[model samples]
Target: MKRFFAKKVITALLFTLILFTFSFLNWKVAYPDLKVSALSYWTDNEQNKWEQLSTLIANVSNTMSDKVFEKYTYIETYGYIQELLGKNEINNFEVIKATDGTLHYTYFTSGANDVSKLVERMKRLNQAASEVGSKVIYVMTPDKYITGVTKFERGMPYNYANETADNFLEELADEEIDTIDFRDLMKEDDQYKPESFYKTDHHWKIETAFWAFTKFVDVLEEKYGFEFPNEELYANLDNYNQITYKDSYIGSMGRKEGKLYSKVEDFTFIYPKFDTNFYFYAQSGSQEIKTEGRFEKSVTFTSLLSGDGDVYDATNDKYFTYMDGNPAFAEVNNFNEPNGAKVLFIKDSLMVPVASFFSLGCSKVYMIDPRYYYGNIEKVISDYKFDYIFVSYTPQNLTEEFFPFYESNLPGRWWMHDCPFINWNGVL
Candidate 1:
């Protein structure tokens, strides 16, 4: 019996060794040609060669797993079961079905560490703005769930995002920071309907953004004495040509849930009816492109119905149709408002539409996403001599570790390339 057991053990060990050898060989052949950059520490020295081998093995394993799940029927079945059981969550997003027959993507809340980091960043931002003699208005846009439009019960384990945002705003208030909590206005507005936000996406509908922009304009005028051209242009939705694509969109959230679980949503594109000329200079990576024409021609359109392509591509992301899909840095010189106040807007994806609308009030809008912008932001502010500085971000963006002011933490990254730490004391 001992002899038989020893033989079995030897066989098992040989089998394991053979399997590992095959895996190593497969990794060598299928390894991705990753760019050797400062961001990756593996490309440092010959001694660190093991790092590449390990990473290649991990990548191959993940690729194989993905292929398995893609073809396996049981994996999809399990995902469906998880969705029905309310256990489906991917990348902090879970599809919640509202009583109104609409699906919404809800995200997890910010932890204590995230909130604390956000508060610290905001304090630093306040000091930076003071030093630069720029008035800062921090705007926090609410998620769909924050307005109480969903049918789900409050205080669910997944519903703490609103609470996190509230806590952050409360802390900001305690610090006497100037802020615009749009969630309050959204909740108070009687005109807001279920359609105010996208049924299948995490972003608010264009109508909702327009409504919020109007209220924001009021705040700007009342608080900062800034004047916007032709409030009537925006006040009346009819003034803009509205084109609706029925049953057209499957948002970032819905795509994750798949068509089997999440229903399709509609998309509406609104453009100004009045004659306007906008010259946009957009820079991403090392490429810079300049375009000048009417709003429809000048702005990059990602919508399938935008007369760009023949068939509607399911992968066509319409969210990026605004401001050409959020370039790392962009400058819009509005000929319509030449000599108007120059404004510096730092924001996340939430401000895509808002930045376009801002052109009506400002001569030039310098927009940058700190996540992608690598240049020294302090230099941009000083060069433009911006009359107003607006910082807009959603609660989820606020909780991100790489929030605008904390870009220094991410070394050799997109936000830190060519970026310099501002001497707040020297500016003051």
Candidate 2:
């Protein structure tokens, strides 16, 4: 029996070596994608222990950016070892100690390159909108640091380096571009903290997102003469001292960390009244998990919002399906009447929740985020002849705007043909 067991062990070792050789060759052949497509799948039951072999391969993979690799090294090499053994879900976000024991996100380096680029690019886009007839509006979203407190073992409280943000907003208005500052609508009550916007994520809390909804409604009414009924949104400022979740939160950017226990502030289930009942036609080609409840609920009942909540819901399920460039269609059964004007929205993921309320004002709203839409934008717009063209973006990727509306198929506009407008030689 001992001899037979030894032989079996030797056979198993040989087979493992052969499999590794095959996987390595397969990955090497697919290097341009960094074997990113191949390595994503992890056999659910195989995560018994960390694999040193996988780590060595990850070190050798040529295409990974250092930033991306550092953030996901565990998944790229070790696999999800503890989870397979049925250990509790991991703590997704950990504040690493700096030299002085100050905790911070692994990638929380300070810089303003992103916001500066975004506003400048948006100015050009806003100018393009003016050339064509529709006006542009800038909506700045509040980061998690601004709206609420994130429970942390941290160093110092950090605010967005948007010192130049207000100047940029003023610059847009100085040029006569229409704009909305949403920070005005956020709960100013001192108690709101990081956990309110997203229980397990970096997003603004649900009710706060809804407050942004109120701002959009009021502003859209002022701009287009559309009517939106008054909404009394719920804003919970008291009882924040109570302990909840206890580190089980896994935010959007933080989810990769895999930690399961985190403490956070939570919102109540109070629903606001809406005048019209709406229908949600999901963006096709999606395998998204449905969330439940009024908003992104606790980990104990994550399905609470199912993410299909009313657009007014922070995790509003309605328009986001299309924000990523899918066919997320929304409609009001009897929208009072004359609901005929068409419009196009060029935006990013931050605009997803924003669109939830904006879509309410227009009879026909066609929103397309260029990152997800590979088609020509002008062609899409000319085909539809939208009455208004609105461009919105968040501070994170604001500077990276491509001429999403530029298309060879469309007619040359007077502005495009005439450089004279940009540089007037003493006269128009």
Candidate 3:
């Protein structure tokens, strides 16, 4: 009995020591930030003493939490423990793992969001574009959670993003705004299935985006009388070199859930085997960067795949390999097909891969992510005068964050400049 009592005391002492070590490490990491925040309380005249104290406490608390030693390892270990317990919910249920071991972002919501304001803003944007003889088409990308296809265990939470998308699309159609609902294709089209999406990520797979690119071309040709030379050649999968990097990618949600909870997925890299050249340009503020060369050398960030470290690390995000991740504004000038359509895409991150694929058969493809862009969007539409404009967004992004045209600053036309590939004069 004495021996057992001694063992219990030793175990308790060791656990206390381990807790102290972790706490000390976290405090050390947060010390500098805490010092700065505390000092700012004296210097800052913007708020009252109580408010400043509140802010300082909040900052210190956040730093201590975020700067915890081996934070990700702790998270991964926690996820593994959760898996062992057959837990469906993780991270206070901010992320849920389906029975199939897929990580998904979800929240508790009672019903669909009010999308009427979003529709009105889109209508205004459409009217602005139409005034300049440019047609606007709202392209609804599929959400990761397909209504009937993805199933959660009993008593699991659901965020109503799909239902919200349904109402949003119906409202857009009622306004006489043109739309292509990819959800309908996901349900009816035999070619596309739940497999089209990434199990661990919110976005669809790169291969799925390539397939959607072909559909976009068909829409342009059949509905709008647009034509691209060598359309079939570009659309053919055989024309591209397909390389699959097995068990490489851990997507946005997967990063949160960790490797033990979410299975790593295969990332397939597809690019044209044909001789292709593109002048890629991206701009933010007064700064501009351009890459001009073959498709592999220019658009795709090959360094992402070749970089050192575990591919599952949140830093080595493979989904961002296309278009070098999202920027405020970017455009691709396709030299191979000079006579192709000049198109503009106002989109979210999901369309990055899709736009990259669409650029294959286009003379120029201008893309804007409103979430990051601060420019005058209406002015840009009037200035560029693209043949057709596509406003693409995933269902989860139907909020005002993606529709910021009215609030966008009229920062004057600063992008008009001399470039070797760009037609600043707007001549096709």
Best by the lDDT measure: 3
The deviation in Å at residue 213 for candidate 1 is 1.9
lDDT of 1: 0.64
Worst 10 residues of 2 by lDDT: 419-428
Candidate 2 off by > 4 Å = 1-110, 114-120, 147-161, 187-192, 222-226, 229-249, 261-343, 381-388, 401-428
Across residues 297-405, which tens digit of lDDT does each residue of candidate 3 receive?
Answer: 8888777887467555554788888887787788889988898888899999888888898888889999888765655677778788998899999888999989877
lDDT of 1 at 68: 30
Q: Which candidate number would show the highest TM-score if scored against the true structure?
A: 3
Q: What lDDT score belongs to each candidate, Candidate 1 first?
A: 0.64, 0.42, 0.79
How many pairs of residues collide in model 1? Answer: 0
The TM-score measured for candidate 1 stands at 0.73
- What value does the lDDT take at residue 54 in candidate 3? 60
- Clashing residue pairs found in predicted model 1: none
Q: Compute the lDDT of residue 78 as modeled in candidate 2.
A: 27
Ranked by TM-score, top first: 3, 1, 2
Better of 1 and 2 by TM-score: 1
